[model samples]
Target: MTGFQNILTLYRENATTLLIVIVFIFTFSNNYICKILPLS
Candidate 1:
């Protein structure tokens, strides 16, 4: 029981980190693409 709980906690932490990284990359690429294109 304790082992399962530990694994769950670890997974949650990793998921949060992954979500942050994904969001950062998405925002960075969006801005880069917008700047490259003349969308005014």
Candidate 2:
């Protein structure tokens, strides 16, 4: 239970950073991959 609580606390603290990272990855793949690769 303590370990689960710790994980939840860490997630709450870094939620914004996690969201930004996810968004950045999605954008990078969508824009760069489409532009560089032949298939889109």
Candidate 3:
């Protein structure tokens, strides 16, 4: 049971980190693309 609980916490942490990374990537890419698009 203790090992399972540990895994759950680790998974939660990884999920949050992954979410942050995904958001960062989207934001960065959008800004970069906007800069490259002069028609916008």
**Per-residue accuracy of model 3 over 1-40 as CA lDDT, tens digit each:** 9999999999999999999999999999999999989977
Best by TM-score: 3
- The 0-to-1 C-alpha lDDT of every candidate, in the order given, reads 0.98, 0.91, 0.98
Give the residue spans of candidate 1 off by over 4 A.
none
Tens-place lDDT digits, model 1, residues 1-40: 9999999999999999999999999999999999989965
Flag regions of model 2 displaced more than 4 Å.
1-10
Residue-level lDDT tens digits of model 2 in 1-40:
9999999999987997899999999998899888888864
Q: Report the candidate with higher lDDT, 2 versus 3.
A: 3
lDDT accuracy of residue 22 in candidate 3: 100
What's the ranking of the predictions by TM-score, best on top?
Answer: 3, 1, 2
Clashes of each: 0, 0, 0
Which consecutive 10 residues in model 1 have the weakest lDDT in total?
31-40
The lDDT, on a scale of 0 to 1, for candidate 2 is 0.91
